[model samples]
Target: MSATGTYNKLVPEPTPHSAPYWEGLNRRKLLLQKCRGCGRIRHYPQPMCPSCHSMEVEWVEASGRGVIHSWTITHHAFHPGVREDLPYTLATVDLEEGVRMLAQLRGVPDDKLRIGLPVRVEFETVKDGLTLPYLVPGEPA
Candidate 1:
């Protein structure tokens, strides 16, 4: 949590459905839920398909690459623990796989953040069972 200069106040509480995602992050891989019924991908994993209302679902590995669709520079921490790490960037990334994810942005200055900025995922091991995915500026192809 502190490794990237961000506060480690919040740790994800993975549910049964979200366990795969957290587990994948531990291995430095990004995993997203894919609805078999509609061939749609989604984050914040859920039990049924949103597009088709089907119960058939599967897990797929994400490329971990995305473009910043939107972003916000937080000047104050809603959580007290992160108060020291003020002015951090949080972004909504549109993944290459067609789903959007909210993750913290690292290695990118506040002034440089913009829509359509390419980003790639990186993992930080916060604890034994917790590994957080962060966004770093993606390299040019």
Candidate 2:
């Protein structure tokens, strides 16, 4: 937390299956796992396709758009890392690509937070050369 509600450091490790996804983030490009077998895009970058359990997974570029599926305004810090970022937002965005992502929302006041609000993805570089995606509501996402 650099006096900004950007991101906090987690134990950093990128496995082989998830490396490409991280690489795309380094390039400021959003990527998700697209199952080659069933042709469905998914998140969390699993080793096997969720729907079909096939090992054929490919990286697909996201439109970088989504809507607020759900969210919560936090006031407590379970860890020292998030104490400074109190009253921040943690939201689940339902992406247009059919995958959902959990992230913090920025540039919007807390009172304006609502369900099903349109949001668009933007990456913020926190630390360790890691740029994490964030969302802000506007214009149908």
Candidate 3:
């Protein structure tokens, strides 16, 4: 990995269904899969809709606004690259679009975290021209 954790770092192995979601992040966008048949939005892109078992789906851009549904503060660095950034918050946020996403909650102290705290999406560029999305406390957009 690069000195600043900018290269050769672990990222999701994108499948064909998930490529668009990952690709969206490169442009600082959050893309979710919406099932045409059931109108359900889902993350971790899939070929078929889990709600309706339909193959018809479309990529939709998320509003990037959400509220913390749950979270945990990690005191241990599970990965070497994140050692310097330890004691970070990992959160499950319920997006305004009705999808829940799990991402690192950035710029928020452990003492400040609470359920239903509004958040917005932010991107962190990683290795191989990819970007990872994180959440930061903010007003709903």
lDDT (CA) for every model shown? Answer: 0.85, 0.82, 0.85
The TM-score between candidate 1 and the true structure equals: 0.89
| lDDT (Cα, tens digit) per residue for candidate 2, span 41-118 | 888888887678899988989988888888888898877777877878999988889889988898778778787888
lDDT of 3 by residue, 51-129 (tens): 7899888999999999999998888977776786677788999999988999988888777888889999998776556
| Candidate 3 TM-score over all chains jointly | 0.89
* TM-scores for every candidate against the unseen true structure: 0.89, 0.87, 0.89
Clashes of each: 0, 0, 0
Best by lDDT: 1
Instruction: Rank all candidate structures by their lDDT, best first, as comma-separated numbers.
Output: 1, 3, 2
Across residues 1-141, which tens digit of lDDT does each residue of candidate 1 receive?
A: 445554458777889888998899988889999888988888789988877998777889998888999998889879987787687889999989988999889899888888888999988887666788889999753
Error of 3 at 98 (Å): 1.0
Model 1: lDDT equals: 0.85
lDDT, candidate 2, residue 90?
Answer: 90
Reference-based lDDT, residue 14, model 2: 87
Superposed on all Cα atoms, the candidates' RMSDs to the truth, in angstroms, are: 2.6, 2.8, 2.2
Whichever of 2 and 3 has more TM-score, that candidate is 3
Write out the backbone clash pairs for model 2.
none
User: Over 4 Å off in model 3, which ranges?
Assistant: 1-8
